[model samples]
Each structure stands twice: as structure tokens, then as C-alpha cells.
Target: MAKDRFHPSSRGLSHHGMLPLFSHHPVVSEFHWDHSVWGSSWLFLIVSVLGYVISVQIVKMLLSFRRRPVPLGPIPALYNFGLLVASVVMFAGCLQSTMAEIAETRWLWQRSKTPFEWIICFPMGTRPAGRVFFWSYIFYLSKFYEFTGTFILLFQKQNLSSGHVIRNAMVVIMCFLWLQFAQSLQIFVLLSSTGLYITMYVYLSLCRMGYAPHFENALRYCQIAQYVSLLLASIVLIGLHYYKEGCSGMGAWLFGAFLDLSSLPFILVVNKQKKQRHVFNNTQKGSITSKTE
Candidate 1:
């Protein structure tokens, strides 16, 4: 969950010395993402990455010793289903809260459009640390559970490369960054990513059950689209951050932009490869059909 930038400052609290009940409360406050140990600290982030590496290695070593193929059994189903539920909940909760915020703060859209006006400008003002932030926290916490996906991949003996490790690790890092920064644009990303997760796991689960799912290409496109969207947003957000004042966590935004650039090319290449393979498969199928005819 993205922390409210107001939490650290005394101004964000109520004069009565108690937390307010509503999002509209001046002192009501959101989670402070940069608060010491948990948010933006190098110690926590480094330890987390190290722990991830060690734990994943341990699991892979243990699983590799097994002579038989690791039985997936009901685990993947349960994991995917649980993740689907989580994604759905986050999407719905975030969307509901965000919509309410938009309605309440009618200028939000105008602000969003004029990136230079507000991209990095909101730092825990009256913008209600509402449902969106709540679910964002949940999403952040959920990144831990995602390690199970890596474990599952290891169990299936998937290749483990530096790129794979970084990709998996980046999710944790990005989620942490998001919590600290609470960029408004991330709200859209959270919603869209959750929706994509739901769609992806639905097809994945179907395939696991022996269904000949055909949406693999579509899912890949969606995934690629996500990267592309983030890359574009990064450019705009970074540009706006330079000219605008009051946006919190410029460092985090810069780091995020670097990550966006790093990942975009890989995703684009994968998308291109997938497209070529699809076309080739279609061509082969057509040729076979003609021969039979």
C-alpha cells in the first residue's frame, strides 16, 4: 500500500491528537512509504533481495534432488485461484475508492491530463487515503505470496537465469517503490495489472486442466501493452517531475523510470517473437490443410 506523504509531517494529523475517520480528514493520513525501515531504506531492500535469492535457491536445490517430476497436484490451482481472488478484490476495491475520489475531487482528471500540473504534485493533501491505498497495501503484501509462483516454476524445472531472477525481484522492488511514492498513476496500473492477472490465471488454470486455450497471444499482447504503457507513463512522469514542485520521491520515480527502460526492450522482443511464431504456425496449418484437401 502506498503510504500517505502526510504521515511524516505534523500537518497531516488532526489537532485533536486522534486519527480522523474519513478520507477527507486533514490528519486522517495514509501510510508513509518512506518511513524508516519498511519504506525506501536500502537496508530493507537489500536484505529482501538477498533473502529472495537465498530462499529461491534453497527451494530449487531441494526440488532438483527429487528423481520424479514434482507433482503439481492441487497446488497450482489453489495458488492461482487464491491469486485471482486477491487480484479481483484489489481491482474492485481500488477502482471503487478511486472513482469516489474522482467524483469528490473533480479536478483530479484535469490534473491527471496536465501531467506537468500534478503528476508528482500530490503529497498527502486532502486526497483521502481511501480504498485505493488500502488495496495497494494489500497488493504490496501480496508480492510475498508471489514467491510461490517462482517456487512452482522451479518445481517444474524452468530455467533460472539472471534475467529471470531480476524480473521476479523487480516486482517486489516496484511494489515497495509504489507504496512509498503512491503515485496517482499507479492506481490505474494496479487496476489494470490486477485485471490482467485475473485474465491470465483464468487461461493458465484452464490450460493446467488440459484445455486448449487460445488466448496465449492475447495475454502476451496485454502483458506487452502493460510494459509499453508504463514506459510511456514513466517518460511523462519524469518530465513532469522536473518542472513541477511538491511531488514526493523524485528519486524513486527516477529509479522506476530506469526500470521501465530496462524492461521495455525485453517485453518488445518477446512480443515480436510470439507474433512471428503465431504467423508461422498459421502458415504451417494452412499448408497442411491444403495438402489434405
Candidate 2:
């Protein structure tokens, strides 16, 4: 049973405050990703992605005739703020739970290896039912909630704001695989991503409030830097997977790599679109200066 794997440690809590995160939570511990769950199927993935695309297309068609954006009235900012809180909590919980797992498990094997090594390469035979994995599961489920951001953007005629169907679906796929296989490298990726998300949600919220809209370029630049860094980490994991005692869920990681790589071009394209926000900001600044003069 899943309960057997997560019985509390005999030793006192390794990390002071983090013990409760994965320790005694019945929902977190007993969770499984098989047919027992609602969102655990290929059909769900296909239907969700297609459903979102179709709905967006319908809205776009309707709006083409009516052709005016609805005033969202603080909704967008609140949405971003909500996601910001989620990201922060996820990041902190995952980080703490992950460190606890490593601390507890390191002595069992490869006692000399650093925790960073484990992040890229989980020990073989790692199961999907542990404390660390609970966070991954939460991350997977969170994707559905995130779909709201896209729709909010859609209704306002900015549907592509920070999310779109392809990107959202890909996230669902990758996160699903991470939990399904208890894949190595996902923790690192998830942890790093939440950091980026914190920045992004803050940036988007400010923009929605009609402030710092011009700083999107800076956010994109940060994302590109993270992409490059994670890409390098992927290469390292691939190398370790081949050379060392194999890492758990590496096969899933391979599939995830393909999906992750596919996004590169999309990221590049969006970065290039620029939308002249930078130029528009500078022009506005000049106009204000002239009027003041």
C-alpha cells in the first residue's frame, strides 16, 4: 500500500517546519495517478486541449463580429495575484519537501553524492507515491486551474496573455509524465519554474493594473536565460542517465525533453513579436516630457 512507503521517520523531523508538508497529510500520501483519478487519461488531455482551442476559436469568432473587449475591472490583476500566491506556496513546499526527501534517502544509496545530483537523477526504482512526488502531483493538478488565466485573457481580447493552448497542453503533458513516472529532473525544473513564475505573475499583475507593462521584455529575457540554463541541465541528465546506474523515469524524461524542446521556437517567436511595447513606452515618456516642458 502507498501508506507503507511514507510512514513517518523514527528520527525527529529533519527540516523543522517542512515535516508536516509530506508527513501526515492523508490526501498527499494516498494519492495515485491511475484510472482512479479524474484527470489521468489520454482522453482527458486530448479533450482538454481541443476543448480549449475550440472555445477560444468560438470566442474569437463571436468577438470578430462584436469587436470590442469587455472591461475586466481588476479581475486580471486579481487572477495574476492568485497565481502568484500559488506559485510561491508551491515553490516553498516543493523545495522543503524535496530537501527532506534527499536528507532522509541519501544514506540509503550513493551516500557521497550531493543533493543537486539527486535532483537531476533520482535513484532508480523511485516510486510515485512518496512525499516528494506529492508535490509533483499538485503541480500536475495546478495546470487545470491555470487555464483560467488564458480564458480571462481571451474574454478581454488578450487571450494569449502569458498562456495559450499549445503551451498549456504541453505543460499538462510534461507535468503528467513527471508524476506518472516520478521522473528525475522534474523537481529541479519545477522548482526553477516556480521561481520564474513568481516573477512573471508579479509582472503580469502589475501590467494588468496599467503599470510596468513595458517590462515584459525584461521578463522574456529572464525566461530565455532560464531556458538556456535548464537546457544545459537536461544535457547533463541525459549524460548521467546513459553512464550511471539509470535514473528513474528517464524514459518519461526523454518524451518530456521532446515536448520541452518543441517550445523553443514558440518562445523565440513570442520574444520576437515585441509588440512595440518598449517603443511605445519610450514614446509615451517623451510625450509626457514635452507636455511638462
- Per-candidate TM equals 0.71, 0.83
Q: What is the lDDT of candidate 2?
A: 0.74
Looking at model 1, the pairs that clash are 1-136, 1-137, 3-31, 4-31, 12-27, 13-27, 120-247
For model 1, the local distance difference test gives 0.64
Per-residue lDDT of model 1, residues 57-113, tens digit only: 888778878866688889978999889889887777666555444343434335443
Best by TM-score: 2
What is the Cα-based TM-score of model 2?
Answer: 0.83
- Model 1 scores worst on lDDT over the 10 consecutive residues at 1-10
Off by over 4 Å in 2: 1-8, 12-24, 159-163, 209-214, 275-293
As for model 1, its CA RMSD to the true structure in angstroms is: 6.5
Candidate whose lDDT is highest: 2
